[model samples]
Target: MNAATMRAVQVVRAGAPFAVTQLPVPEPGPGAVRIKVHACGVCGGENLARLGLLGVQLPRVPGHEIAGTVDAAGPGVTVWKPGDRVGVGWHGGSCFVCDSCRTGDFVNCADRRIVGLHYDGGYAEYVVAPQDALARIPAALSFEEAGPLMCAGITTFNALRNCGARPGDTVAVQGVGGLGHLAVQFADRMGFRTVAVNRGRDKEAIARQLGADEYIDSTEDKSPGEVLGRLGGAAAVISTVGSSPAQADIVQGLSPNGRLVVIATDHEPIPLGPELLVFGRRVVAGWYSGHAKDSEEAMAFAALKGVRPMVETRPLEDAEAAFQNLGAARFRTVLTL
Candidate 1:
């Protein structure tokens, strides 16, 4: 391959397999910077685009959690320079003129774009990212560790920190995979009485090791709500799994005026009974991955607290395998270049 071209994995058509092929290493456009990718983390949301569910344009590269070094910068891109360690997450860019952006809530901007879905992303050796989407990676964090933090890490960390669960309240993290594991750590570290709710006894040991003070084995207990109710209910439940039933089961376990903070991108609607909301004044809300500044803060917090994600890595050429193994990754997956 010449200097102008680089290897990439592309989904040539919806519902089709990812193909390893050559594409021109993109040059940075206006207000953009070109990155020499060191690592790109796989995300569950890619399944939507891979199956044509996200209405993504064909022949796109699919990845959002990216960590790399800036190799070039375009005009008007003063915040980033060549050789800077950086990362980009799901919130690719937004129209700064929108009311949401004007209010400092770019995630809600009508013109907000998502990495991998709205445009090409970090599934290649080089990706051109908007300057506003970039976050500086700290020198203490490795590219592999920082890659997943760009999306999964920031989402879980930001959601729990802002979810209204007090430091001493009983906070339950429903699910012990991917996002839930991190949620448990954050809840415990943040001084909440952390509980891990998972299906089997297999995760109990790890949950305790991760600082969860209690474990709810849903498979053996059958009803998570009943189990949680017996423990005096949770002040907040961070629902991280995609299963609607799992989300529904936890509602009865919420303390009066408690919240169910939904973060998983599940397509199925969570069935909610009106009584659950009316009787207790309970609330359900969703939180998206934050902007670059939030991502930076999440990284710094993780670094300070020694919070790390369990990741399985594959070479860039094995991107297809990395994508396929996302479920079995135990927590998260990263492709290294």
Candidate 2:
């Protein structure tokens, strides 16, 4: 490989095969930092680039769950320095003068910059990002482990913490796959009575071992809502699956004032009756991945509490195959550079 160029996998065209190409190393601009990416997680959210669903430009390096080290700090950048371990997620940067940023709600910024969507991302040997988009990686966490935590980890962790469920309250994580697995762990560690809900009993034992107080198979005669209702109803249900009907089926399981947090990206409208929400004050809300500080906190919590993601690793060269098989991965797939 040429010293001036880096090998990266890019979506040369929307809805086309990923192309491995050599590109010149990028320099961080003012207020930005260049990262030597050690690992990048292949996430379902990459569809935004793969399918061009978010107006992502062609020939884009697509990845947001990035874990790396600062290799260069651009002009005017001070908080980050070379050799610092860091991670970057979906929330790349925000216009500080925007109303959302002024109020400290950068995630909701009107002109939020998404890492992979708005600019070149971490599917390469190096990536340049705004300083505010970087999160410190805990010493106890490896690059591969920290990569997924930037996206999946922070999403579930932040969602569960903000779902308004108190300690000892019933909190259920729907689906035991990629995001669901992490949600179960976070819910368990957060002091809630964690319940793992899935389609079959295949993952029941794993769920229990992951700290779920109970497991519910949706295929059983009783619906998940029925089972959760029998168990006193869930104070919050974190729906990690992308099926709207499945999410809708779990609403009746929420206790009075219970919240259903949707983290998965599903465009299908969730059908619901007015009585279902009006009578119980139930809420269905969507949660976007959090900011860099939130990612830092999630990593620190995981490092301190032994919360880890079950991941499959592949070399950066195999990103094409890895991304193609992401749906079948154990939980998360990390691309090692």
Candidate 3:
């Protein structure tokens, strides 16, 4: 196939605002595959990338939630073929020889590159993905419906699945935006007593529709501890947001021995009372997206459980506007190529 330049959203300088323009479509390099993007989901991390937080490699593309067909494959790329449908998430690639990779845990690979930052990402029509990080897009789902899962879906899915969330356990999803919404659905299918914890009762109906068995509006009841007291405490509380205020709100809400898992946010200087950790308890942290295989398993499970993201799709050229809108909107946005 003849290669041609394509339109892309590029942040050409660090600490400066982003802009959109055309750039030549990239060719697959060694151990890589060039994906003809179908849809690219805007992520919160991408905003961080935009602000030069991920080491500020400009001109940056700043998108990782990718889904598309493989248009070309590079030497040593054995896993994919031209025209095959695939998806890429936050994890772009990993050093295969690293200890983590040797243990089949690519997510922990020390030299891993994030999709939009470490490597050129999916905000354009073509994105170069590492052979080891690509996951097959399930036939049951469409490009738009499947976009956010590449990141939001797999990350939240891996969190609970990896933590051994079992049936009938009480799982509380704190914040019902991008990640929290899907977490509720996953918890529900796992047979957990799902609880959605958010700021207002406004999201109650929405949370319930996503399979939350109960809702706790933190604004009305600032004490998540008292609110969760009604459900007898949660087996685990997944704080989807990392802002200091949000972290401070839910860290103490976990049950005795129950864990608090934080993902994709800056939940640092985690202010916790010393008394909260007196027992044989813990607060764990992890990335939401998993290995390529883990992503595939997450997709299959979502398919089986009827868990899907509620997304809005816009044309690829509108990526910049879409991203800005994403920062303000209630639901996640997917850019259709």
Give every collision pair in model 2: none
lDDT per residue for candidate 2 within 220-321, as digits (tens), equals 946688889899999999999999988888998999999999998578999877787999899999898999999999999999988999999999889889
Give the Cα lDDT of each candidate: 0.88, 0.93, 0.81
State the RMSD for candidate 2. 1.2
TM-score of each: 0.97, 0.98, 0.94
lDDT, candidate 3, 184-298, per-residue tens = 8998998899999888788899899989999988888668756785668777877787665666556566677777777746745776666766764745555557777877888
Top-scoring candidate (TM-score): 2
Model 1 TM-score relative to the real fold: 0.97
Candidate 1 — which residues are off by over 4 angstroms?
Answer: none
Q: Number of clashes in every candidate structure?
A: 0, 0, 2
lDDT of 3 at 96: 85
Error of 2 at 10 (Å): 0.5
Better of 1 and 2 by TM-score: 2
User: Model 1, residue 185: displacement in angstroms?
Assistant: 1.3
Q: What is the descending TM-score order? A: 2, 1, 3
